[model samples]
Target: MSAPNSLKDVYLDEMKDLWSANDQMTRAVKQLGEKVSDPKLKQMLEHSVGGIEKHTGVLKQLIEAAGGQAEPEHCKGMEGLVTEALKHGIKEASSDGKLQDVAIIAQYQRMSHYGLAGFGSAAAYAKVLGMSDAETKLKQAVSEIYKGDEYASKLAEAVEQAAA
Candidate 1:
């Protein structure tokens, strides 16, 4: 659906969508942490989860500041990603610690890329809707996520080569 007619409506809708994405990250990261056998992989997933929580709080505050509600809308998109992550983490994960590390890294990198795209779009929409502050926040988050994706790719590749 399109954004709301008013600024407040736009803020609330964006807030709900962002919150939903963050919540999904929380759940998915937990599952990633649990299923992956490597300690390093688990630590990375845990760290990402913390970041997601921080982003969620920021979105919530922005929504409230804009006179909009700050609750999630049960983001089906992220839900699907999380579900797939769990399934892959379970079935595709290797008994070899290094292989599992590579797999987990791949999963998280993909998710980070998705986050970058999502937040980038949201931030652009927020800017167009005249929520410059929210746009800045989201765009910054997107930049971080893009960096994270690059980092994860390198990490995963290193682990994969080591495992080879």
Candidate 2:
């Protein structure tokens, strides 16, 4: 996308970038889910795929609502995070189930945090532009992401304790 001359452009661009980010994250989460030994971790990852898809839909809606094409511009930031997730959570993952679970949660949270930042920023932009509907949806997505991140943190703690 070209440089944004207005807040609307930035907001739309953020939504488009989030679309690509969600798509990339969905694939990575699925791959991570398949590799996880912990049933709880696996379940969370599976559930998150659906959540990510829903958020992707919201992003599409927001982009179109703002009179922008829903087409996603590839997010280089998410691309890097996904690469790191695969490398650490899968490629160099430990043989120990508990250790691998820790790595997976860490990777998942890293990606989720990026989403939180993007979605939160988009929501702020929407609020500044007086688009209450857009702001509400974006904020909702951020809240959901935060919930997942919190769950992952708790799960990580449980896994670490179990390994001790």
Task: Score each candidate by Cα lDDT.
Answer: 0.74, 0.95
Candidate 1, 9-47: lDDT as tens digits: 655775687688788778877877887665666677778
- Looking at candidate 1, the ten consecutive residues that score lowest on lDDT are 1-10
Q: How do the predictions measure up, each by TM-score? A: 0.85, 0.98
Report the backbone clash tally of model 1.
0
Once fitted onto the true fold, the runs of candidate 1 whose alpha carbons sit more than 4 angstroms away are 1-3, 6-11
Quote the lDDT for 6 in model 2: 98
- The deviation in Å at residue 120 for candidate 2 is 0.1
For candidate 1, give the lDDT of residue 94. 74
Please report the candidate that would top lDDT against the real structure: 2
